[model samples]
Each structure stands twice: as structure tokens, then as C-alpha cells.
Target chain A: MNRDAPCQDEWSILVVEDHPATRQFMKLRLRKAGYRVMAAGDGREALEILKHHFCPLVITDWMMPEMDGLDLCRAIRQESWEGYVYIILITAKDSQEDIVRGLEAGADDYLSKPVHPAELLARLQTGRRILELERTLKERNQEIARLSITDPLTGIYNRRYLNDTLTVEVRRALRYKRPLGLLLCDLDHFKRINDTYGHNVGDLVLKEFAGWLQGSIRGGIDWLARYGGEEFVLVLPETDLAGSFDLAERLRRLVAEKVIATPAGDITITASFGIASFTPGGPENHPAPETLLNEADQFMYQAKKSGRNRVVGPTGNQ
Target chain B: MDIENTARNLGIGRDELLEVLEIFLEASVADLEALTEAVAAEDRSRAGAAAHSLKGAALNLGLTEVADLARTLEMAAKDGVLLGAEGQLKDLREKLQDLTQAIQA
Candidate 1:
């Protein structure tokens, strides 16, 4: 509701008219009506102002020396901008055919000239309303895109994001002849904890574990994602097998020592880690993402078989 | 030139309208000069453009007499007819002079 309010004071309207008197009158009335105003002698000057400054609303006269209102509208529509520009064309030619021609040339609205102050203000209000609606819709679309990639419970990247981004990371590493490492980790006996303390406590422990893992990684070089229930994957760029193994061992110990204090009580947990890495040797050695994931899964299974709370990498157990 | 009535009709304050009128007078003078030269040279396009500019500004300020005279000149020039354009130009000059005196008074 606050966004819907007429916040005219925050807006600047560009007035383009070759006639100095009309331009002055429009500027005075617009400023008096709580709008900041900028004036240009013609459409050419208007474009120059728009290049350096952002003005969402424009009122222009149909006839001017350098460029006219109809051409200005067409020029504005041809370019790409961060936001929409609302244009109103002022014409003395009041014929219906002329109105249609103006609209066809990309004018959003048209005003008959000898512009009455009240009518000018009213038309500008309509332009503001349309621009506000566009802004709200743009923001909503960005939010929706963000929500699609985020995990609801842990607030981390979800499996879909992992699938989408991991391939890109792998391709980049291979193309650049760099190393890429992956660590797949699962909490030891997670189902038993869920059955013993109830699913609520289990969910809390998972969220806390995710937070810890996220914080421990290199901020931009490494990323963590919720692979599935109680399992997470960390992708480390430019990290070799040894480096990933070292990180895995450190994380395994950290998980074993951490005491997650939940509403139920303090609970200690252990986790198993399997590390896999790709060092680009040649085209023949390039592996698909599924192969890398499967290799990590097998190493993790070996870690679980030998003992819980341990790290298994390509070389052996650690 | 009833400044109060004109200002009220245009939905603006008298002071603000007067400020605009000051600018209008200066700009219209230049336009009048341009129209005079264009009519002398029989350049219909230039004359039409100058008259068009004057008409737009005069109409905005509620100066109906000036606006009506400007419209007649503009239409004649647009039709490529410069006949009697001198008389219209003379009438326009007198009206502007009267408005200037009124403002000074």
C-alpha cells in the first residue's frame, strides 16, 4: 500500500519543447505539483539528458527544430533501458488521424496543445501509475527467480541449482585446464537421530550443519548445496584431489566435535565424507558429471563400510 | 490582457503566469523577427515554422488575440500563400506591443 501512494516528490519529469514559453510554464507547474523537473529545448537535447540521467516520465511537443516528439518516442522505444519510459506527446493538430499516427510512433499518450495546467498534471499522474506498476512487476519477477534456486529449510542452494551450476563449473575447469574438486558428505546415522529426537530436531541439526559447512568454505571459490535429505555437496574450484581430501578430513572432525543445541537438547553428530577431483590431463580423461558423482558416492560408501565419521578419498582412507 | 482571468483559466497563479509571460514576450519577439524575414524572402516553410512557434506559446498563455492572428499567418504560409502576410505581421507586432505595455503598467 505504501508503494501505491503518489510519491510525486521523488520523480523527475523531462519536458521537451522548442518553445521557451511553453517549456517554462510546464516546468513551473510540474515543480509546483511536487515533481522535480528537467527541461530540454528539443528531442535531441532530451536524448542527451536521458543518456546521463534517468527520467521515467517525458512530455514533449510535436513540432521542434532538432527532433520532434514522435521521433523521440520511436528513438526511446528502440533502445534497451533498465526501466520503462512513459512518454506523452503534445500536439496542436487535434485530428483523430494525427492522434493515431502519434500512437503508432510509440507515444503512450497524447495531449492537445495549449496545455492546461490541470490536464497536464492529470496525464502525468497516469504515467506515474503505469511506471510504478512496471517497477513492481520487475521486482516480483526477480524475487521469483531467486526463490526457485534456494533451499527452503537450510537457505542454501538446492539440488536443482547444483545440477544447473555444477555442469558449468566443470566445463569451465576443463576448458581452462584447471582442477575441480567435489566432496559429498552424509551425516552418520541421520535416520536414527530423526527417529530418536523427532523430525523437528533432525531438521534443526541439518540447518545448523549446512550453515557451518557454508561458512567454512572459500567465499566465492567454493559453494555448498543441499544434495538431498541429510546429504550435501561442496564444489571447490581450482582444488586438486589432495586439497579436497585435506578439507574433507577437517570437516569430518569438525562435524564430530560440534554440539548443535536445539530446542530439544544438545546433540552431537558425526558425518562421513568422500572426495573426488578432476585434473584436466587431456580430452580422453574428461569425465561426465555423473561419473564424478558416482565416483564420490562409491568412496563415501567405502568410508561408511570401514567406519563412520571418517573421510575416504581417491587414494585411500584418511 | 486580464492577467487574473487568464491565470485562473489556465489553472495557475498570477505570479507564475506572469513569469511565463515574460519569457513568452522575449521569445515571441525573436519569432516575429524571423517571420518578418521569411515573409520578405517568400520562404513559406520558414514563415510557417515561426508562426507555428508563436501560436503555440501565445495559446498557452491565454492570449487569444495573438494566438488567433498567429494561426492565420501560419495557415497561410503553410498553403504557400504569402499574400496579405505583411498586414498580419503588422497586426501581430501591435498586439505584442500592447501586451508589453500592459505588463509594464
Candidate 2:
């Protein structure tokens, strides 16, 4: 895939040098090259700037008052940052031992001073290339993480995500003595629709149903997940049985009324909803995630038996 | 010093080189004072640090005479010998004055 061209203005290079004239010269040259520049008098000041602003590239002088370039490299490596910092240590010391010491202290590259502006810019371009590679890899890893927890068809949370998070929600609710509600829903006669209108139409109808339910729920407070084919689970925190029952009833009617349009034809479908809730002082023993799921599953089975397209709660069918 | 050639070699315009030279002149004066005090007190580390700072800035601006003198002074201070440091400091003052006049012209 073609990516957007990298903008030079977005690449900020931090210059750490104790000499005022040299610092000014570096800032001037880097700014002329279209890069954003930040300057510090010494390594200590550089650390202070880094605390507030993120700079991926650093050009430092080896010998400085208070903290030197080597110490700065070590300190930066010790602290965990959101992204990698590429350091280029600029020094007049050209000995082999000094180069090895600089690298050992975490300098990605080294430059001998007096640093020609052309050479400095070239080295920084190298640093930017590496930083760009790191950024792309990090973004791809995050995308993979997101895909692992997302359902491919409906673009909602998958069963694996539900299993992992539901346990955490249960622990949190119990620890905080807060009420939690779980709803298990199944599309009524989903397989029959697949048989009558082909699986393509059935898939479209399922997508429509999932989208409708996802839009109707509280975004961050409540979450909906596809438990399996034609079955979904909604976990609601800080919600009691009565609240969940009302929501399930409302959703039952909405699903029954929605007409889903597909390439084959338009189809109307209804869903059966079952809700189970945990109150702080309830008499239910050991309200684990499995117990809640089983209770909701039982109520959903009851709703399916009672002619379908209805909502069932712990109290009774509605 | 060939100001135009130095500016071109450093990848900057002559005007920008002049601006940096002005800053260099001001900073080197301070470094010179610090070096003077360090030589009077026979403080080897302070004298070496002062000379090192001067050498770095002068070298960046392509002031060869100033940089060479400052490097010599730095080496002497580092080795804990201030024998010729006073004369070198005087010569460094004269070189900086000559640079200021050249830039002004």
C-alpha cells in the first residue's frame, strides 16, 4: 500500500550542546532544512525538554557541564518512552575507544565535529529513516492486536474478546460492590432465513442486526460482542436487573421492526433476548461470569420456547 | 579567513555565518574571561573546560587560528601544566580581535 509522504515539519530534532554558538548554528541549519528544531544547553536541559515534548532525533555534544552526552544516552535508554529515541553523538573525540563507548551508552550513530551542515543533515536523514521504520512496525503491531479481538464479518468484538473482558468485568463489579448486567441474544429462526433466501442474504441480515444493536447501546459503558453465529452478548456495568430488562425489551421490539435490505430482497427479522443481573446485596451465591452467562443462556432458551421474538429476564418473560 | 568559502563549506549563507560569528565572538569573550580566572587560580579542570568550549565554537565557525590556539591551551590545561597558558591566552585575545575586525570589514 502507498503511504502518505512523510512531512519534514513533523520530524523534530533535539540539539543538546553546551556551547551557545554551536547550538545556535545547529538550530539555524536544521530549521533551514525544513525540520523542527529544539535546543538545550546541556543534557540535563535536554531531558527536561523531552519530558514535555516528544523528539525522536537527538544530536548531542559529548562533553558538557552537569550531564554529558554519554550519560544522557544512558538515561534516555533507562526511561521507557512511547517511541524509540535515535541519538547521534557529535564530538571532536575521534578515537576508536570513544566511538565504542558512545555506542555502548546507547548512541545510535556518531559524528565527529566540526559537524559540516551537509554531513549533519545526511546523518539526520538516516535517523529519520530508522524512526519511520519503527513507526510503521509499531502501527502494524497495533493493527494486528485490534484484528485479533474483532469479528471479521460484523466488525464487533469477537467471542475471544468477550471471554477475556467478561471475566475482568465480573472481578471489577464484585470488588467495587457494583451491579452488573449480562444479556444473551439470538436471532429468531436465523437458519431458516438462510435456507429460504440463501446464506448471502442471511449474512447481510446478520450484519444489519449487529450494526443496529451496536449503535443502540451505550458506547463505552456497555459492550456488545458476537458470542458465535447468530448469537451475541451485551455486558453492562453499573446496571441493575430492571435497567437491563427495560433495555432488552426495547431492543426486542426494535429488532422485530427493522427491515433489512439485501441484494436478494428485503427481510424482516426478530431476536430473542435474555438478561441476568447481579445486585450488590443479592442472595445469588458466587456470581461468577460463567454463572451469569448460564443464567442468561437459560432465560434465552425460555424466550425461544415461549414463541420467540420476546424478552426474558430472571423475573419472567416480558 | 575566507568568509564566503567558509560559509559555503558549512552549507549556510554568508549573512547567517555572520550572525553565528557575532554569537561566537560574544561567547568566546566569556570563555576567555573564565580561562583568565582559571589560569590565575591554577584550576586545571576549569581552565580545560573553558578552553574546550572555546575550541568547539571556533572550530565550528572555521576560525583556524582561534581553534588551534584554544586546542593547545585545552591540552596544556588537561595535562595540569599552565606554563605557557598566559602567553597563549594573550595570543587568543589578539586572534579573536582580528576575527572581529575581519567580519566587520
Candidate 3:
């Protein structure tokens, strides 16, 4: 099958029938319609093909040798596969009881053979359209997932993403006995900067600082976020105090460089950061995540108290 | 919440945090002192590291303003760029000294 084409990649149709002649005819018709066709002589072979291949559309004869179409249809329904599998029961048996049993066996729809090519084509088209819609929905879902994690303003991770991902990182740090560092950073007197200078200048300063942070940061695994307001965050997995301190200083220095351009004029801004690391500082020995955050908050305030545009954490010397 | 319980939840006792803050303050003074001397001597790395250490100490205590000042000094030193704002550094140091005293209190 030439699956190189986008339309043909998932365009496989499985045909199962006991009678070889009729099966061959159906195969010819489906192939003509640009469908890749795989046929099984009976139910058993059909099961093997289904197992090996992801056949999203299946057509089977209602009565066949050994395991009939009804049993095969039931089996397909029971097994879990992501793609939608359309089963059409081809039978000369058109009684209401027979149709009920076929439907009960999970035949998506029924067809009485001497199969009508036009009807079969219409049904297959419907299945194809449904699958196409499903594919579009799946892609949209993935795009939404990507957007949810990103902060629109700074093009960094958003706080919601940080909180969820960090909870997992926190547990992993505890389990693996590796250190994780959290840097909680906020602009010093940011509210004043915004209130006095107006939001435009405040926004320009934020963008400029974010650009600096984006440059100094290395590695894909390091997660950065604008926590909220003037606050921003970084989660350094597998980073001890030593590593985090180095990065934090780099970040602090980068933010302190100079004035960011704004419509009003060039205005200088500074930030303060509080750093905390996994220091056997679990609930028992020290405190929980919130408590640790509080400590870091206090430390950041201390940084503000001492001077702005600084990084602080547990002393690496200790 | 009961006032006492709420206070406790707020970590009002300040035992471990205080100890941690005290160590940080000690480190801060030493760092600021080093930074002051280094700036006077035009020793960039020494000045930067000193400012950097105080910055870290300030961060631990949630002193944003002080940390920002120290960070500014640290960055200038890191770039081998001496800040023209010499007076700013002096003012920051005095403020940091005041913070060390406040943390003690």
C-alpha cells in the first residue's frame, strides 16, 4: 500500500467472506475506489489480520465457516483500539431476527449480498467522513493542550502548568533523592512601577526582563513561568542549591542590566528572587511546599530589604 | 480560624525560619562588607560575589528591594562593568545593614 499520501495513510479496508468469488469481486470494487484491501478467507484469518493491522473499516460476510461474521463482529467490538472500526455484515439472511442478531453482535450496519456496489460505496464514504472528522478533532485537542501550558504575554510556561508539573517534580525529587530548586522572582516595587509609570512601561520592563531570562536559560527540561502579577518562576529539576544559585545569579544579573524602552521613555527596573531547594526539607524535617514557598517569599523580601535585583537561596556553603 | 492557630499556620513562631534568617543575615553583612571594600578597590569579581551573596541572603529573607540592589551591583561586576552609580551602592549597603538589624530584632 502506498501510504505516502495523507489520504491513503489510514485508508485500509479489511474484507472477510467464505466464498472466494464474491470476496474477489468486492476486493476489486474497493481497490478501484482507491482503498487498500486485505481479505481473509474466514473468521480466523480475519482475526489475525485485525490483530496485525489497524483496519479502521471492516466488511464481513454474516455467515461463514467456523467463527461466523457475527462472532467476529462481537470480537472486534470487545477489543480496544483507538480508531473507529466500521463492520458491515453481508448476508443473504435478511429476516428481522437475523438483522437483530447481527446488530447485537456489534455489526455497525447490515447489507444483504449479492452486495450493491452503490450502497456499499455510500456506507464506506460515511465511515471515511466520520474518521476524517475524528482526526481533525484529535489534532485540535493536541493544539489546545500546547496553548494551555504557555503564558501568552512572555511566551513562557503559565502558572497553572507550573503548579501541576511541579507537584510531580516535587514527588520525583523526594523519591530519587536528587535536589530540586525553586526560584520565585518578582519585580521590586512593581506595583509602584505600574501605578506611577503606567502599565505600558511596566509591560515593557517585563518583556525586556523576560527576554534576558530566555537568553541565559539553557536546557529543554528547565521550566520557566510568569507565576502572576509581577511574579515569575523557574523549576530546576535535578538541580541542587549550587546549580540553582549559579543560574539564579545569572538570571538576576541579566534582569538588572539596564532600562527597557517604552513609549514614555527608557526606565530601569529591578527584581528580587527567593530560592529554596529540596534540603531534606520534607514535611517532617522542615515544612511542606507551601511552607517552603513562604520561606522563599520571606527571603525575597529580605533581598528587597537588602537591595533589589538579587538572587537568594539556602547558602551553598552550608 | 482561631487567631492562635491562624498565627501558627502563618509560621509566626519563627524558630527554624529565624535561625535560617539569622545565618542569612550574617552572610549578608559579610557579603555587603566585601562588596563595599571590593567596589572601593575596583575589584569586580570580589564585589560581584559579595553583592551576589547578599542578594542570595536577601532572597532567603524575602527582602526584595535589598536583593534587587545587590543584584544590580552583582551584574555590573559580572560584566566587568563598573556601575557609574557608586552612590547607589552605598545607599543600598546602608539599607542592607538596616535590614540585618531588623531581622535580628
- Model 2: what is its DockQ? 0.52
Per-candidate TM-score against the hidden true structure: 0.93, 0.96, 0.63
lDDT of 3 at A174: 78
**Residue A298 in model 3: shift from native, Å?**
2.1
Question: B-chain TM-score, every candidate?
Answer: 0.95, 0.95, 0.71
For every candidate in turn, the CA RMSD to the true structure comes to 2.9, 3.1, 43.0
TM-score rank order? 2, 1, 3
Q: Can you list each candidate's DockQ? A: 0.56, 0.52, 0.00
Among these predictions, the greatest TM-score belongs to 2
- Taking the tens digit of each residue's C-alpha lDDT, what string does model 3 give over A49-84? 988987889999866668889889988888887777
- Candidate 2, residue A272: how far the Cα is off, in Å: 0.7
Q: Lowest summed lDDT over 10 consecutive residues: which window, candidate 1 chain A?
A: A1-10
What is the DockQ of the complex in model 3?
A: 0.00
Model 2 misplaced regions, further than 4 Å: A1-9
Best by lDDT: 2
lDDT score, candidate 2, position A120: 75
lDDT tens digits by residue: candidate 2, A1-318: 111234545788899999988998888877777778999998999999998998999999999989999999999999988799999999989999999999999999999877777777778888888998999999999999999999999999999999899999998998899999999999999999999999888888888999988998999999999998999999999999999998898899999888888887778999999899999878984587889999999999999999899999989878
Every candidate's TM-score, chain A alone: 0.93, 0.96, 0.80
